[model samples]
Target: MASTTEYSDRESLGVGSIVGESFSILFKNFIAVILLALAPMLLSSIIAGAMVGADVALGVADPDFSTSTSVTTWVLTIVLQIVFYALTTALLVQLAYDSKLGRPLQLGRYFSPALRAALPIAILTTISSILAGFASLALIIPGIWVYAVFSVVAPAVVIEGAGFGGLGRSAALTKGYRWPIFGALLLVGICAGIVNFLAGVFAGVLADVGSWAMIVGFSIIAALSAGLTGISIALIYARLREIKEGVTVDQIASVFD
Candidate 1:
């Protein structure tokens, strides 16, 4: 299933092209994209509820920062975050390929690959997060650099099934293309930030009218931002793979060849 397409040879589609293509795919399957984006939030809530229920049954009080309950919550949150992000990554990778091939999108195709890809994705994601954290602690530039460098980790994990090796693969693929990835990531961040800022402003206005609406709206905005960010990251991975692995639109077109 590897046909080299013309787009594959055009690695210089650069930042604008990448972002445009991502948004195009997103809009084409807006409903599916939104639902995929919402999946993590919904799953998290369900898991948290179950945890809380178990804690209550065991007579556990609300967790304070010093308590085991707090630790458990943090652990659960991290695990859930990894699983959700991995799943989103796999789904988006499949979607990207489908979009490129002019094939119909299918929601059912998302989960299995996600599950298969989870471990490597989780490891890469965790490492990237840690590196970013250390860089942030050192200086903002380093943190941002680390983030840009590892931007394609999810895509590597999903497409290559690189597992723990995904981070290294992403780094290698992105070696000469740092600025492009950085620009794309920055663009996504700026757009998401704007959406978030607008959401906060709207929430404040709604709060003045009704607190519940404000809370609900804020929650929805947060979930949408997460999903959109995840999808954008996945798109970046696809583009990088096409460039690094020499997998082009033509190759994609001649999958059976």
Candidate 2:
């Protein structure tokens, strides 16, 4: 049964192959992926709107973030955003891997594992951000490189229960293939961005009749885009491990076991 989803005989995936595989997985499980992604996407959108609204109310295009209180607030907002992202990303990874393993997926049951992973993932995300920030400080290219390489850390944590070591595990798995990973991810990002821009424009131009309607339209589109991207990343992580370590879908899905 393990061989059912094995990629051991296939050559390692390149940029285009990974992107194609990701979209294939996403389309096959579109409803599940979108539903799993909605909560975090909605919350993130609201947070961003609130921040922008607050800035508008303050009458400052760029507020005094240098102030202690403002800095603290900005930091807290960032932390909350990361926490939401971590939770949502973990859920998506579980969903994607389970679907690939041919498990009967239940949305509610998936949250349990994600909840258990919340704290460790939050910490892992924060540390990765810091490290990526320092790397960027050294050189802008290194920062982008660090982010692309460590992109699979969240999925590693979800699949392998690697805790904080997920960062190292991801780095290890992504070794020698960072360029392809980066290219695939960049393609996903571009596609997602285009979707988002179109959604926003559609909402603003056509759905301007009601504020709530616009918000709902934008949120739904954003959720779909984010969900697809998340699923793609999860697939990328799984295939990389399969190619590099002979890991099977059942092994990646064993977190559910």
Candidate 3:
């Protein structure tokens, strides 16, 4: 019984150690972390731009294009956005897990894995978004709960290379630890909110002071905030994987295996 107790304690320590190691990797690979964080925002912007451009070319002048005649345009836009996000995540995970710091991180490396993982990732996104929306309707707390559960979905898809099945897997891994995940996400959310609030306050002050300064400062703040958030999520995912699956960096790299 004592030996069994010792083994159980060791297992718990191992989980804590994995989480620590994940954060260490994120801090150590700061640049990559930033890129991972920014990727989603950048991809969203690109997709939005393309959709707007297509709407313009079609002579459809409306703030909302969902009612547009060309369903293909909307489908393409959604597909492209998913593909882009998946690819970005794949590249980031590949680079981070492989420890390929010196290699030139090109755009192409992101596409294949993204394409491979696109459908599952997109489905996960849709389901999570719907759940979050429903939660919001219920009240703020439910919304937060939904986000916490699905928070690891993206990382699960990218790092574990699991498809639709991975979504449930992530939820399972997060089980019995929802509060901890919630706490970590809450902290990040608070920090991000504060940063945005301060930036907005500064922007307001700066606009009164100097428009150019406001523009530059706002841009810088947005980039930094997005990057930091992305890195934090990626790192969290890595740590969760380690805890749930005993996946080391090496195993993450061997995701295809």
- The predictions' CA RMSDs to the true structure, in order, are 7.3, 6.1, 7.9
Clashing pairs in 3: 37-230
lDDT of candidate 1 over 1-257, digit per residue (tens): 11224234455737887778777776777677767656655465445545543232112235335888777776666566555655666666666667657877776766676777777777678778778878889787667778877877776676665788877887787776666666687787788778667766666766556544554455456555555667677666656657677677545324222
lDDT of candidate 2 over 128-242, digit per residue (tens)? 7877788888786577667777788788877778888988888888776666666677788889889788767656754447554555566677776787677777888888888
In candidate 1 the C-alpha lDDT for residue 66 amounts to 83
Can you give the TM-score per candidate against the true fold?
Answer: 0.74, 0.80, 0.61
> Ten consecutive residues with minimal summed lDDT in candidate 3?
1-10
Model 2: what TM-score? 0.80
Q: Which RMSD does model 2 reach against the true structure?
A: 6.1
Tens-place lDDT per residue, model 3, 162-212, is 688866977776665555556566666666677666755665666555544
lDDT-based ranking, best first?
Answer: 2, 1, 3
Report how far residue 205 has shifted in candidate 1, in Å.
8.9
Each model's total of backbone clashes: 9, 0, 1
Question: In candidate 1, how many Å is residue 71 off?
Answer: 5.1
In terms of TM-score, which candidate is stronger, 1 or 3?
1
